[model samples]
Target: MDFGPFLLLASLEGLVQAAVLSLTALGLCLTFGVMRVVNVSHGEFYMLGAVIAWWAASILGPKYALSGYLIALFLAPCIVGLLALASERFVLRSLNYEPEATIVATIGILYIIQQTVLMSFGPDAKPVNPPFYFRIDFPWFGYSGYKLFVIGAAIVVLSGTWYVLARTRVGLIMRATQLDRDMAQAFGIPIKRVYAYVFAAGAMYAALAAVLIVPIRQAHYLMGADPLLMSFIVVIIGGLGSVRGAIVAAVLIGMSDGIISMFFSPTLAKMVSTLLVALVLVFRPQGLFGVKTS
Candidate 1:
């Protein structure tokens, strides 16, 4: 009954899990806040990003592993974002003013993208090994450098996003559009353009998370589904359209999942997390940091 070591491991695992959730949810928050689209296939972008990393690493050889990672880190998001933009422009735009039709259209896009990926890459898992340096560990808690990197990277990216959103002009426009699309438009903001940019940005965020996580978890076509669900839950728990809420909720969920999965079974851990989300929905439907909408 060595709870000490188990607890330590669980905490680390939870943090990793939370980091992944935050990555995915950030995308959801961005798009949902601006475009009001759920983008169900968002998880597929992670799968695609990871696949891109794997393919690049394999095709380019060890000398190019770092290059491949770098490429995936940049290219994956751009590809997904562009795809989302095209979809929005051609498909979603046509379904304007019809929320239900638009949702269904996005779902169709998700399946099409998923199946197309499967056709191209098959259904097997593909690995993307981290660089050699990541194998080393720090003195404290035997935490691998790679895990630390993931945590640190998540913090830096999220922090940078926070700074930009809080300080930048585009960020202000995005916020304004999120709060009131019509008013923002009335003030000369191009509502359609905002929707396109935010959707692309959201997809890019999701892809970035995908590339980051691929080093830890092998890539597979279906890899994004669980993350997608978990992220939605994180977004729900944190309060919709609140970046601060997403961060807070991500850390909490990460810690909770890590600790619970360590002591109990993973299935039990999932059940507990879902139950927590349900409770939040029932009691504080607005979310921990979500502002109430009139």
Candidate 2:
């Protein structure tokens, strides 16, 4: 392929990556920003989503591709959300959400989930059949229609999330809680309930991202590490609790990954991203969009 065509294709791939990363990192940011909790197991939830999606594919069969995908699209997030809710209730809540302790607790959860999946699902990567497939033939090249759908879906989900956080009463309460937990509680916001739901919401975001990406990347036991690391990088570069920032950072990182990987290698792309993060940390520790506190 010519350089122009290659670059165009790379950019499209990067946009897709950004879309998925936005959802995953946004979830991480929400948990950290609102609940002040670090969920080391967040990536596990993503892995679980992909695994469940593969199960959905298995049950429904290739003949029912679209149906299977739709079922997994809705079902996986719900299941992951429930698991997140339960973990928040039983583990984080009992530990009082102390930063250091919750970190340790979630790490334990990560290992448990990883090992369980390893034992049950085995170590092989499972490919998922996309719900439907069509190719958009450009003059220079072709692209997957499903990937474009993913980009649109990401836009819709991000917009809805923004509306809820910025416009709705539910959002108002959550923001109030995020801004001032003691005051919100004094005003009758159920702090425990909010944290539980928020945690679940975060996990659901990760799961949703996984569902969207599973067909492309397939399901694997150890796939969570990259998403988890990139999410933390996104959160750091974008500014904690800044939805807009997270989206922007995801695009920046995702696009860079795509373009660099096209010309050189994926590993080099990651190294460049990490270097960007290091520079950001040194120059703006609060993140590109985060607020500085006294």
Candidate 3:
């Protein structure tokens, strides 16, 4: 077996995975950092995004002679955000300041979403093909143009998020809220509205990541499981609410998964990744960039 080409493909796949993981982790960080809720059901939200995108592309894109793919890309995240708003307003709002209860509620939400999708679309996988197939070949590597596009789009979204959170007034309020909800409320910040916005924004990011991943993994009801695990490991290693930590951990995890899968079995690769996450948590429970929690 030729090692050169194999390594190149693995590198490309790793880059793509890293980008997806980072975007998803960013969403987790935003929610965890701001709401202090351990949302274990975020993976289901990602799956919803992918499935919604696939259905929209199939139903609306072709019949009206429109760009089904583009429509999916735009609409799926919005739908996810709307769902997040509904969930936060109704369920999560009731569980405010109750982290354990919020976590349990999110888990319930996850199963509900999974079963709902299964009932609506059945358990079969759905394919979302790109509009065009073009590869930009280079001396070092060659990969699907669509995959490259996914990476590019993820980068753009992550960068835009960073800009918003770091530069804008809303972002300042978000950060202020994350630092201390009670304090922010005392200082005239609309704490409830901030929570809603953060939840919606994080949901939007998760949905967007799922939409981008469809071309790579296809769509299925249970597709959220693995990514959800990966995202949790990332958030844990990076630290809650630390976007930089998430990115760094995502790259490490992505590269580890990619290189290991190339040489070993998928099952072994996952086992090793889980072990690594455990070790990280044992030593640094707060995560690499996480603030110390009382």
Q: What is candidate 2's local distance difference test score?
A: 0.92
TM per prediction? 0.94, 0.97, 0.94
Better of 1 and 3 by lDDT: 3
lDDT of each: 0.82, 0.92, 0.85
Give the alpha carbon lDDT tens digit for every residue of 1-294 in model 1.
Answer: 256766767788888877877888999888877777777878877677778778878887888788877877788888888988898899878888266887788778878888998998898988887854544543444566777788878889998999889999999999999888889999999999988888888888888888888888998888878888788888888887788898788889878877877777989878877888889989988997877777
What is candidate 2's lDDT per residue for 1-294, written digit by digit as tens? 888888899999999999999999999989998899989999999999999999999998999989999999999999999999999999999999999999999999999998999999999999999899999999998899999999999999999999999999999998998899999999999999999999999999999999999999989999898899999899989987777888899989888887788889888878878888989989898898888976
Candidate 1: pairs in clash? 14-258
Give the number of the best model, judged by lDDT. 2
Clashing pairs in model 3, backbone N/Cα/C closer than 3 A: none
| Candidate 3 Cα deviation (angstroms), residue 117 | 0.7
**Model with the higher TM-score, candidate 1 or 2:** 2
lDDT string for model 3 (4-35, tens) is: 87887887888888889888888888888898
